[model samples]
Target chain A: MNTTLTERILGGDVRSAGRLMRWVDDDLPEARHELAALYPHTGRAYLVGVTGNPGSGKSTLVNALVAHLRASGKTVGVVAVDPTSPFSGGAILGDRVRMQQHSLDRGVFIRSVATRGNLGGISRSTPAMVQVLDAMGFDVVIIETVGVGQDEVDIVRLADTNIVVTVPGLGDDVQAEKAGLMEIADIFVINKSDQTGADRLLRELRTMLHLRPRDAATEWTPPVLKTIAVRDEGIDTLLTNIEAHTSWLSAHGARHQRDRTRAQQFVRLIVTEALSHRLNHALASSDWQSTLDALLARTQNPHDAADALLNAILEPR
Target chain B: MSQEPKPRTYRVLIGKPGLDGHDRGAKVIARALRDAGFEVIYSGLHQTPEMLVRIALQEDVDCIGLSILSGAHNTLMPEIVRLLEAEGAGDIFVFGGGIIPENDIGPLKEAGVRAIFTPGTPTTEVIEYLREACANRYQ
Candidate 1:
């Protein structure tokens, strides 16, 4: 049964891939088992992350980018991450609405993930979802984040090509320079280019990019492209720049370094998960309960109690 | 004894099938479910039965709440159930809401829809039913 499902998933069974993603979302042990079996087939798909302020039309740009990629006959997988509702723990996942044109096309697979209270715009299971799609043989995987935030920069850790999308009339150059996005953007796009302040935003971004010190080994400078995504304008040039960036990463042997960082993050996430689970288990013990009680009664300080608990759990186990 | 496994959050796909275009009910339920702590995937308007099932399968949702007001519930709801069964995903609990009339509710239930909620049903009542249904649903 396992082999059949794995084989089906590897052969591009969307249902199987989705089932596996469900496992990942629930943090089921089966997901780890399945990923272990499918790990060898991953590491092929190009991951592109698109993130920007909420009204910047990142989803529309992604929809346009998907259309352009499909025109080139490449299979695409999209993971649109939306904020989880703190009140109800639900998400609207409205990004799919803008990309509805690709719904009927089997060449594209789109899934929306709630951030599940993860600070970053991406979901905790995003990297696993990307790996699942990659093993499923998608030529490209696009991760659209939950708009822009300081924490949203986490996408740069996972995506080989990260596009920081901005629009005119939102803010001046200082506003752009203030966010964590400037450091991570491999390509900058000024979407909604026909708007009133687009030229000023473009000129300011170029000036900012020029003023920033260049990395000695960084050959590809982040290019700011203009696009009216709703009308499907400038999508081709955007794709071209993305391709150029991908080629640069490969030729400069930086793809391996990026992959290494991604793997490192994956390992750290797993370790964190494991440690957290163990900590929760240990906290439930009678000894820890008494420790908490003592602290509550002012017999023990929180720092000492915490240190003792850490020592007890971390001691040569 | 080892501790019992944590209750995994329920993931639901609140889909609007057919050409209804009226998604207010679907959006309301999606919000209520989310607020009640269920993870929801709001599949927007104009989805076909096939597309709904495809999404259900892909999202691996525990249940699907179909909202149809285009007077095509009798056809679309059953078709979704049929497709889920055909794909060996019959274990996915299927229920629906929208302008479904009282007379058609019986037939929809017989067609494998687990439950039906018509207009004016309290959001709390729906949440309670889902809590129970998903609690006992096959994993």
Candidate 2:
């Protein structure tokens, strides 16, 4: 009668899924084994990523989106990320507060994660937690990143549909005219459209889209939509657009390519993290102290010392 | 780069249960805990015991810090503890802070609340207690 955590997760135990997510966050070595077991059961849940600047209503929009998805009889899982303090490594993951309506819903599972010094607006363990939720049979998994600026495009690699949320009067229209978060969006949401300057922001976004070079016959131009997430306005339209994007991806076979790209990135990240762990261990060894001493004494050049250290770890005696 | 594995970052849930709309105490505590380097999940006002327990389980938090100012602490705090225990998550530490009377603290603790920080208790005490309690819980 004894079942492993992986087995329980596969059997749809939500508690086991939460425990596995905690393990992944803490970087427990056993988490890797569980994830390996759960990998094959993934790829079934559609991943949706919502990102925007702070105070842009990203969480509120996600709350509205989840409510809409649930009304249509779909199970949902959310990974909400908030930034950790660089000084203290702490975070206030208040995203769930906006989503308390689904707190007791069996079909909805929401987990909050801290960036924990990882850049790119999400925690290092976010993808693994997504995998856990996917394996637990949630029909859709939504990732809400920390209030991101420009360079946090990592969500594009993981999410099947990336919705970049923007609010009017934040000067985002001007800031987004550049090529970072603006370029990565599969759909653009001008949230809080009830506010002033909404029309101007929409016009600017449309103009920017118009200027971008694309084959109208072949390319999927990301739609610019408007929403007042707090009042649940325009959410149904947003969901329809999301479903449309999904259909587009499938119709064009782009979903398969995206999956391949995600797999490649995931494998590379695992290898990089493993090697970095080993390198950290190696750097604390006596060999590194002597290498540092030689460098300090000017007896060895910086490049040669780097090569020696790499060789020492790569080809250990 | 440290030789030892990274210390597990403790996730604490600050919840307000029952009809009490006042969450200043909870927000203060949540911010204090965040500044002290703990990931704090804030459960907004008027959460039921069922909702709090469900959030705690889903969040996999190390502790649930309940802030109930309504005279309903007697009814609410123990209910949260009972709900958490019923879900087989009694290991998740339960603590409370609010306008609870002195007489109710013992009964609440007896009902499985680990600690109760009445009004006027410094935030540092709670922070220090959590750090020690969470660190010792695993060992």
lDDT of 1 by residue, A100-154 (tens): 7787788999988888888778989999999999998999999999985454778
Question: Proportion of native contacts found in each model?
Answer: 0.62, 0.80
lDDT scores of the candidates, listed in order: 0.87, 0.90
Which number leads on DockQ?
A: 2
Write model 2 residue lDDT over A1-317, tens digit each, in one string: 39998999898777778788988999988788999999999999999999988899999999999999999999999999999988888888899889989998999999999999899988999999999999999999999999976787889999999999988887755688763877888999999898999999999998888888988766789999999999999999999999999999999999999999999989998888877877888899998899899889999889998887777667744
Worst-scoring 10-residue span by lDDT in model 1 chain A: A88-97
* TM-score for all models, in order of appearance: 0.92, 0.96
Candidate 2, residue B52: Cα displacement in angstroms equals 0.5
- lDDT: worst 10-residue window of model 1 chain B: B1-10
Residue B42 Cα positional deviation in candidate 1, in Å, after optimal superposition: 1.4
Which candidate wins on TM-score? 2
| Colliding pairs, model 1 | A88-B34, A88-B35
Candidates, DockQ:
0.53, 0.65
Q: Candidate 2, A245: how far from true, in Å? A: 0.8
